[model samples]
Target: MVHAFDFTAPDSYILNCSTLLTELPVLERAQAAKDAGFDQVEFWWPFDGNPTPTSAEVDEFITSLENAGVELKGLNFWAGNMAGGDRGMVSVIGAEDDFAANVAIVVEIGRRTGCRAFNALYGLRTEGQDPSGQDSTAAANLDLAARAVAEIDGTVLVEPVSGAEGYPLKRYADAAEVVAKVRSEGPANIAVLADFFHMSVNGDDVAAVIEVEAANFGHIQIADAEGRGAPGTGSLPLRDWIDRAYALGYTGQVALEYKQDRATAFDWLSHVTQTA
Candidate 1:
């Protein structure tokens, strides 16, 4: 049952509570993650559709992490109503102000939590709006985000998501392209978020991407392809991909963002952590 990678390292992986622990309330997920043996956790926008949540809400969030003794390693900027079909506000034409507002909040959160990585999901293509315009808006917002986070020594991440129709960034290269564009414009802190499940589902050569773009990765997330479950639940070389990324000099935490029962979602880690 020995695995090639060491899953016992304290900083090696981050449990993505946003996707994994669905049964628990948002505030409780941090403690749940800690109880599950993770010292770090990442989350999507916790505020329900509100770009600017009250200070009390923010305080509660930080307190939860503190109470659980789990570090907030990564977080998403307010991507508009994810459950209602809005993927992100970054590229939405009229949502520029909201995105800018969210950036400030995210920066403050990063300052308080020592979290340096922030994922900015690119919004889906609008029905009649010009794609070029949306791209421009996205670039502008990304630049703004990068600059805002830079004050906290933070990084802005662009990720390719799957199962999200109209989501423009579906492949590693697609997200990388956006990253390249934003980075070129003077925000050096921007990078691509390599989500293996999304890339694999979108038909990207995940291994090749790791080999070539490891240096450009700000963070790495994984879930088995086809089912978006735990490491061993679907067909993906999760261990090899992770080992390869580490060998290629990528040192960021690997986020486990998958949908599965809490009881068995992390069962694979038990085997991986076992010594021969």
Candidate 2:
């Protein structure tokens, strides 16, 4: 049960249930995380991409965390149809209402779970749509979400994603630019989500980003570069990158958002500690 990294506190790292432990039902992943020695967990839009889920569904989602004795540290606002290739609607032309409606739900979740970090993914570019208009829409939606989450003392996150074509925000600078635009309008608590796997895949210098952009990062997620698997599965120097970020003063939980079977997903932890 030894962890890969010697985190100073139980809450230092979060197991992203949305990606890990896929063999079990979504609700059961929390308990699995707890059993595997994680005190906190995070998720993508969990209700089948439904923005306005039923009251019972919300209750059940909350109950799962409570029963597992794990904190819901991070959550994603509804992005449209992830399986169908929709990254998010914050910037999409026709999905403004859906994005707006999801903001309230996200706030409620934050209020109830003390989850303070919310990631809002920017949607893909629509055919025949102006990029400028999409950027404006993204900024506005992010502002609204930032304001709503701020009521709960939460920060909204903009992440650069890879592997999805037409999706904007492919680099740390891209996301940071969007964050800067939103912040320019007014004071809203928003920051860039530094997912190392995505940034590296998109050809960003991960070490340089950690060195220069640490102050602008709200959260961090990690998976190896070539395959997006566990830390040691690919060529990424993930341990070094994480250490560098911490050395540069990043005070947030690092999320384990890699793809692997539950049985062997965490094997890298021991491998890392042994090598270190």
Local distance difference test values of all predictions, in order = 0.88, 0.87
Off by over 4 Å in 1: 1-5, 8-11, 271-276
TM-score per candidate: 0.94, 0.93
What tens digits encode model 2's per-residue C-alpha lDDT throughout 1-276? 222456433345798998998899998988888877788999999999898998899989999999989999999999989989889889987778988888998899899999999999899999988999998888888989998898999999999999988998899999999999999998569999999999999999999999998756899998986888988789998878887787777877699999998777777563222111
Tell me the number of clashing residue pairs for each predicted model.
Answer: 0, 1
Top candidate on lDDT is: 1
lDDT of 1 by residue, 1-276 (tens): 222457545346888988988888999998888777788999999999799999999999999999999999999999999999999989999999888988899999999999999999999999888999999999999999999999999999999999888999999889989989988889899999999999999999999998898766888998897799888788999889888888887867789898998766766765233211
Give the TM-score (vs. native) of candidate 2: 0.93
